[model samples]
Each structure stands twice: as C-alpha cells, then as structure tokens.
Target: MPTAASSPKNEITIVGAGIVGLATAFHLLAEGHRVRLVERGGVAEGASFGNAGAFAFSDILPLASPGMLRKAPKWLIDPLGPLTIPPRYLPQITPWLVRFWRASLPDRYRASLTAQGGLMRFAATATQAMVAQADLAGHIRADGNLQLYESEAELAAAQPGWEARAREGIEFEHVRGERLAELQPGLSPRFVAGTFTPHWQTVSDPYHYALALFRAVMARGAGLVHGEVTGVEADSRGVRLRLADGQVLNAGRVVIAGGAWSRPLARSLGDFIPLETERGYNTTLPPGAFDLRRQLTFGGHGFVVTPLSTGIRVGGAVELGGLKAPPNFRRADAMLTKAARFLPGLRTEGGRQWMGFRPSLPDSLPVIGRSTASPAAFYAFGHGHLGLTQSAATGKLIADLVAGRRPPIPLEPFRPDRF
Candidate 1:
C-alpha cells in the first residue's frame, strides 16, 4: 500500500467545471487545500449556462413521481411536450426507465422526498454565502418565484404535490382570482391561481454567476486545466486522471463532478449508477423583450419564464436523448410558443435556442459521498434540475467528507454505493 507521503499534502483535483464542480473547488480552497479543476469544454457551457436560472428550493418533489407515470403516455406522444422519450433512445435508457418506475413506489418516493427536502433546506443560506464570497451578489435576486394555474381545476390537480410539500414543511402562499394580478401585474388575466414561494431565488445571469465562482477559485490559488479526462484510476494513495491528449494528472484526492458525463468515470471506479441524460431546452428572448418581477412557471404548459439580466429566458422540457444525439432546438421553440401564450404581450422574436444535458438519476437524488472503490475518490453528480440550487450545499458536504469531518446533513441517502 502507498503511504500518505507519496502524494502531495492537502491537494485535490476535481473533474468537471460546471456549477457543482466550481462550487466544490471554492469550498475545498477555503479549507486550505490546493485544488485543480479540469474541464472538457469552456466553463458553464453545459446546463449551468442555459438552465431556467431559478433556485427552486421549494421544488423538492422527485421528477419520477407516480403522477408523472400516469401522464407519461400522453407526454411521450407529443414530440414537443414537457417530457418525451425518443424512440431510438429508448433501448439505451430502458434500464434507467425500469429503475425510475421502481423509485416511484410510495415507500421509495416518500424516502426520496424526505432526503431531498432536507438537502434543499440548506440551499438559500449556502448559495447566499457563495454569492457573497464570489462577489456575485448583483447577479442574484431573492424576489421569489410563482407557479401559475390558468384554472382552478389545474390547481386542484396539483394538490398531491402541495400536500407532499406541506408534509416536508415547505411553505407557499396560495393566490387566486384577482389577487394574482396584484402580485404580478404583468401577468396575463388567464392565470386565475398561483402558488408563490418567497424563499425561491433566481440568478440574473447563471453563466456569469458560474464564471464568477470559477474566477474566484482561480484567484484563491486553484489551477484550472482545460482538457478532456478520458479515464480516472484511484488507489489507496491517490488518483490519476488520463487526459485525451495523452497527459496524466495526479492528486492526493479526486472528485468526480462531471454532471451528465459522470457515469463512465463512476463505472471505472467500480460503481454502476443508473444515471441518464435529461436533454433540456431553453430560449432567451432579446433584451427588454418583456418585464417580469419574478420567475414564473406556467403549470399547464410545463415551462418557466424567468427575468434575466440579458433577456427573458423561457426554459423547461425533458427529452430522453442520449449524449451523442444532436440537439433538437425545436423543443426550445415549443417553449417559446408556450411563453408567448402564457404572457400574451411578451415579445418572442430575436431569441437564441439552447439545449444541454441534465444528469438525472432514477430516484431524483444526487450521488454525494466518498467512492466505495477508493477512499481518495468522491462522487457529486446526478442532480438533474436542482444542480444550481444544490451546488453550494453539495460543495460543503463534499468538503466535509474529504476532510474527514462529519457532514452537516445525513449522507446515507446520497451515498455513492446506495444503488
């Protein structure tokens, strides 16, 4: 066995430069560890760049809920619907689908909900600290977010989720009738009811926010390496990363935070995770296209329209296409169509379409613990839509685990070996 002195003292190398990876680097740097970040592409170019930008802390419900299964048939039929599975991608994702179905069972769903709710409870404070540390306070808004329902029937259908949230101690204000307009004057009269969670926050510019954190990490003495990590090998001493360009990097510890691309590395570490890519789409309208005081989710249309520093961003939609498939921008166009109808007066021209992969697990829970195959390796991916919301808290947890300190929250549910 290799001794501790064989590796550099207090050094850690992290793979992936997305929000979660950058946030982890920041946290590890604060702990007096020398850190290095490796990225295949430019920073924040993945889901971090084009997400809905809402820190949906109140949305603790798992995506693979029992109700979602009931609606799957209808959604799958519509190519541009909120959720669709490409017929060609079905074979590749069938095992993940089976796991998703099992996770939707009442017992498993409750357990996931409880675990997710606990992690989200620390979102606001953790993210606020990171924002302040990274000097990104200007990029964040704490005005809350709203989920709109065009009719009372639509709101009634969402009661189960609301009840689950209530059981988890999640709070929200129910608005109906004329009160909706008072809360959001710019909203269309079609929205008769809404649920507002004041604790939900939004990033005025998600890409910039991530970049700020990345720069902060560099300024704090962490090095950033631009290369593709093809494989990772860990042992009792440390870990070695093989780059595509025939370069090898070694560190005292390694963290796999590659988001949608983490599965292969996890497998190399002897952990087989049921991680799948949820291809999500977004469209950002031209500057001043519309005015929105807070982020709004159109419940019936299953999309979110958010106010950003650059423009009004309309995003939301799930396509189960593997990583190799070309992006289907039509999904983004469909979101724009829904945004136009949700806000009748909004301008939808001069917008850019984007699509990125969201790392999703069957249970809708992130893997955030030390690797079972190697003590020097850690895992922190499979966050799906909550990556931005949970990044800071996950970073703190990873730092704690690496330093051999007890985590602030329970880690049993998020163990890498759980699957």
Candidate 2:
C-alpha cells in the first residue's frame, strides 16, 4: 500500500497525460477525489491525437486473427504495407511476435474478441456520456463509418470475419457494386464493396477533445503536473509517485495509463506486462481536393482516409519499431499515395506528417484492471489502436476499482496478470 501521509500534499497521482490518463482524471474528479496528473508531453499529442478518429464499436476483431500471420511476412517486406516489422529490430521483436502468433490460434482469437467487444460496447456509452458531461460533444460526430473494398475477392475473403461480427451482435450494412458508389460518389471507380457501420462515429479534432478533458479535470481543482513519473513506492498507508523532477505525490491509490511508455512503470509494480508500441503515421491533405462524405477505410489495406473540418486526413501503418526510433514519415507519404489511388481527385499540396506510438499488447486487448501482485497499483493502458475509442470506459473502470466498487464491465478478462 501507499501512504497519503508520505507526500507533502495528499492526492491521487496518475502518470501520463494521454487520453487514458486525462479520462481517468476526469472520472476521479467527478467522484470528488483530488488528483495529480503528470505528463511528459502535451495531452493527446502522443498516439491519441494522430488516430483515424473512428469510434468503431463494430470493430471487435483482434489484430491476431487467424491467417494474419501468413500475411505478416509479406507486409514486413513492403516498405509501404499497412503492417511492417523492421529488419534491424526483428530480433528484439521476436518474442512479442511469437506471442502474437500464438494468440492468433482460433480459441485465443475468439476469447480476445469476446473480451474486446464487451469492453468496447461499454466504452461506447461511457465515451458518449463523458463528451456530453464535459460539454465536449462539439468535437464529436455520431454518424456511422464505411469500410470500402476494391475488389470482389477482397470482400469474399473478409466475409467470414463479417459473419463472425453478426454472431457477435455487431450490426453492419453491406454495400456493393453500384450501391457502394451511391453511398459515397467520391469513391474511386475501382471500389466494388463496403460495410456501413451505423454505430461508428468520429471526432473533428482529437487534440481539442483531449484538451477539453484536461481542462475539465483542472477546473475541478486537480493538479496537472508536467513531469515524468520515474518510479513508484508503496507502503501500508498508500502509494507515492516518484517524479523525475524530484517531487513526490502521494495517493491512496495509483493508476498507470502511460500509453506506449507504460511497460517499464508496470514492471516496477511487479507486473511485467508484455507491452509494445505500434508506431502509426498520418498526413493531412488540403480541403477542396479531397472531399470525403464520411471516414473511409481501404478494407484490404487497413488504412483510413477521412474528410475532416480542417482537411482530409490519411493515416494507418503499423510499425513494430520501439518508441525511441526515429519516425519514418515516408510511411505517411505512402498512405497519401494510396489515398490518391483510391480517390482520383484527391491531391496533397504539402501536408503535415505525424507519427505516434499506440501502446499494444500481444492479443490487442488492453491491460485494464488491478494488479494481482499490487492491489494498490492499477493498470489502464495498452489500449493499442482503440485508445481513443476505449479511454472513457477504461477510466470509469479504474475509478470504480480504486474505490472498491464493482465495475459495470468485468475486469478479469483484461486482468494485468492474464499474460
């Protein structure tokens, strides 16, 4: 346990200011708990800000689904593939890769879906409520999303997964041939089919949403500190967060939501969670040239091109390289190249390129509960690609667990010790 008496001032200290951390602060503040949030960088500037902006309730499949392992090798060879494993870093990534491969087994993949789908469903409602409560609904759009395919072959190959979606109660409207073009006229002539998910939604500006959450927490008088949490010390009374700046904050409980940087901090608490980062890239195109009716996904390619309030944004590419590796913005450029092929009229007159790491676990399911070894220490990170979609629900669960209350969603499925 950590002692509140151990600090100069008693407060709950949450490490990392990504969406997850900020969301946790919002929930804790709503419960009238004093909170101290420490961030090494600006909120949402990490992986959260660069996401495709899709709140995909219909996307319940894990990344380790069957048959994906066979495709991984070819993707790694292509510099512009949606998924890539750098040759130099392959040795370091081998173990994680093996674990991920094992997770691709039929039994494990279904289990992951059951866990992810249930959590994401709760996340949908929690996210909506948070936006409304924080008055941040201005940034959100609840209209659905579309995943378009370029060929009949692609559609047929994906039908099994879509069928599984139906069994999981995920509703989808299949659009093919002329019907697909009718829904979105701007699509390329090459598009043959698509799936319309009425439950999918998006945010206009993820950065603004993150800032709103941060401000909401601050308005409640919670301290938002700028520093890195280096270590944690626990005793009979409570937990103490050791900041890099030499300042210490004590809390009756602690939640680690450090995004891609969570693994090391998690280890300090005795949970060596096998967490990794999937660095993703994005690019923004100027307005007039790229006018998409809704967010569009290249089903076979796994990237998305969305028409935004500012401009058209193209993003997606999973790089297994670690967090510190230099960003290869070429990946974003490649995405732009692919986007142009899908939308003939799209043009990029010099756009901003960005890269960020989504904290990922082997099975794509986030680590989202109390540590078995350290009950006082909780984990709410490793949301991977679904951080933006899942943050609010994760925060609510963490808050409920810290207060010794039962979470509306089950926790054991995402327990830190599940590995």
Quantify all predictions' global Cα lDDT against the true fold.
0.88, 0.84
Model 2 lDDT, residue 323, Cα: 78
Which digits, one per residue and each the tens of the lDDT, describe model 1 over residues 318-359? 899989999888888888887887787889888988888999
Instruction: Show the colliding residue pairs in model 2.
Output: 1-235, 2-237, 2-238, 2-239, 3-237, 3-238
Query: Per-residue CA lDDT of candidate 2, range 154-222, in tens?
Result: 888889888988887888899986777766787877887898887888888677678888888888877
TM-score of each: 0.96, 0.95
Off by over 4 Å in 2: 1-10
Considering summed lDDT, which 10 consecutive residues are worst modelled in model 1? Answer: 1-10
Residue 224, candidate 2: alpha-carbon lDDT: 74
> Where does candidate 1 clash, by residue pair?
none
Specify the highest-lDDT model's number.
1
